[model samples]
Target: MYTPKDFVESRLPVLHDAIRANAFGTLVTAGEGGIEATHVPFVLARDEGPMGTLYAHVARGNDHVARHAGEVLSMFTGPHAYISPNGYPGKATHHREVPTWNYIAVHAYGTAETFTDPDRLLDLLSRLTEQSEHDTGQAQPWKLSDAPADYVAPMLRGIVGIRIPIARIEGKWKLGQNRPAADREGSARLLEQCPGDNEQAIAEAMRSV
Candidate 1:
């Protein structure tokens, strides 16, 4: 993650919050054939391990199921926005600032294992669904039980559950912490004026820092 000292975030709770907020992550592994990556949503068990445990599922036919062994990396990306030098308060005077990006990202490293237990897989699916539905602010969140057992059974059989107890974790919050306060504030203001959700989020994060 090539994080500078100013951007490094080592707090456990902070890292956990980032993972939970951005649960859909890229899982990377190296095998005899080559490196493989899979994008999946992960459920974090914060108290399960020293760092945390991640639960996810992949299709039974996914090559990741067979190739994922030993060390694995899961990357979670949070809000990000491009910062234009024009937003810097001192740009007019010094003309030294260049464009850059502000973002939050977390990397988790662990050993991955796969399971076929129907009950465990079902539980994983339910938790993922519940979290996603809650995020949508639905009046009634969907549950696994909403579907027929027979129909779900076949679906469950088509996938494999993955468990990874985090051994190492790193977080980087590049919210212009290294920049001058006036410049940071100026950039944040510009970010808020941008049209995307991510830009707004980055602006908020910059304010907090």
Candidate 2:
């Protein structure tokens, strides 16, 4: 991300929230054949540094995982909305005003190691399920231990767990900060009434800006 100083989100907590809220990320890597990418849900761990670790898994048959093991990029996408110049109060004064996109995103660069251990893979799956299901109400949640060993054993071979040690992380927030206050207010007002979730998100982001 070509993040300008004004738009940079350097706070580790904010960056971590971005990753957690948007757990799904695109993994990119290169190998002898060429570049490959895969979309996967990631589990982010925040320990030291403003940066954090990324844990995810792919199908055993996915060749992309092998190439991405040593190094990879995990991207997280936050709320994004379209901002029309019409929403700007200064549109009349600034005839050159144009529509723009308001959004936030984070890119994580890291080195990954794949785990072939069956027990580890099971543990990873448990953690992933718990994290993802936290918000959803499931009176009786599902668990690997609840499943029979015979069925679970075959399932384990189908996936591979990969751990990525964080090398770098970048976050960008573009919420019409460059626009005049009047324009910002106007755009935010229009967004609040918009029906889509994305538009509502923009409305909230503008308030923060």
Candidate 3:
């Protein structure tokens, strides 16, 4: 991540929030077959380690897990939107403004390992289901126990679990931090009026900053 000084976000709490909010991340690994990437939802354990840990899974048929070694990179992307030059107050004065993009992103680096134990796999599945269901406000969340053991057992056998103990994390929130105060305010106002959810989110972030 090539983040400028003004856009860098190093606070662990902020990084954790971004990871939790955008749990679906791209997992990248380099091996003999070159680089392979997989998009998957992750479960972040904020207090599990000095730098935290991430949990996810891959299909048994996906051979990427078998080749995963050393350090892996997990990228989480948050709200992003286009900012037009028209939104900058200085555009009218000097015509120096240009269109840009604002976004929030987090990159986590860590050692990745795979687990195939049935017990651990079942526990991982259960935790994933619970967290997803809770997020959706389901009154009666679905459970692995809802299905017959024979059916669930076979299904669980089809995937491999992954764990990454984060060694380092970096976050970038490019929310007009480099822009002048007046220009940032103008951009936020224009973005807030836009109908896109991402634009509105950027507007809110700008205002908060």
Candidate 4:
């Protein structure tokens, strides 16, 4: 991530927030042939290290996991939108600005390792399900144990568990931090007025940031 000083998110808390908001991350690893990537929902454990621990899994038969054990990069992408020059007040001055993308993304580079332990896999699945529905106060929360043992056992065999010990974390908040104040304000207004949920959220981000 070639981030300029103006767009770097050095604050650990801010970086964590971005990762949490976008838990589904891209897992990248280098292999004997080349690089491979898989999209997976990750659990980030903050207490585990200075950065954190990342948990995710893939299908057991996944051939991509076999060739790599080196460093892995997990990318978390947040609200992203395009800022149009039309939003700028400087349009009246004919400043002629190019459109740019505003977004928040967190990249975690870590050591990749696999977990084949049945107990660990069960625990990880339970944790993942809970995290998925943590906001809902479901008295009978869904669990891996809910399924029949026979079914659960077979299902577990189909997946491979992984833990990535985070070595470095980088965050990028390209929310017009490098742009002029007037242009940024105009972009916010323009994006907010546009259609769709993603763009609206992006607009709100520009204003708040």
Candidate 2 is scored at a TM of: 0.92
What ranges in model 3 sit over 4 Å off?
none
In model 1, the runs with Cα more than 4 Å from the true position are none
Q: What is the lDDT of residue 203 in candidate 2?
A: 86
Instruction: Candidate 3: give the clashing pairs.
Output: none
Q: Write the per-residue lDDT of candidate 1 for residues 1-209, one digit (tens) a residue.
A: 89999999999999999999999999999888788899999999999989989999999999685765589999999999999998898889989889999999999999998899999999999999998888998888888899999999999999999999999999999999999899889999998888999999999999998
Query: Local error of candidate 3 at 125, Å?
Result: 1.2
Best by lDDT: 1
Name model 2 segments beyond 4 Å from true. Answer: 48-50, 68-70
| Tens digit of per-residue lDDT, candidate 3, span 47-163 | 999989999999999878678678999999999999999999888889987799999999999998899999999998888888787888877989888989999898888999999
Instruction: In candidate 1, list every pair of residues with a backbone clash.
Output: none
RMSD (Cα, Å) of model 3? 1.2
Q: Rank the candidates by lDDT, best first.
A: 1, 3, 2, 4
44-150 per-residue lDDT for model 4 (tens digits): 78778888899998998885766786788899999888778788898778777777888889999988888778888888988888887674678877876778988
Which structure is stronger by lDDT: 3 or 4? 3
> By TM-score, highest first, what's the ranking?
1, 3, 4, 2
How many pairs of residues in model 3 come into backbone collision? 0
CA-lDDT, candidates in order: 0.93, 0.85, 0.91, 0.84
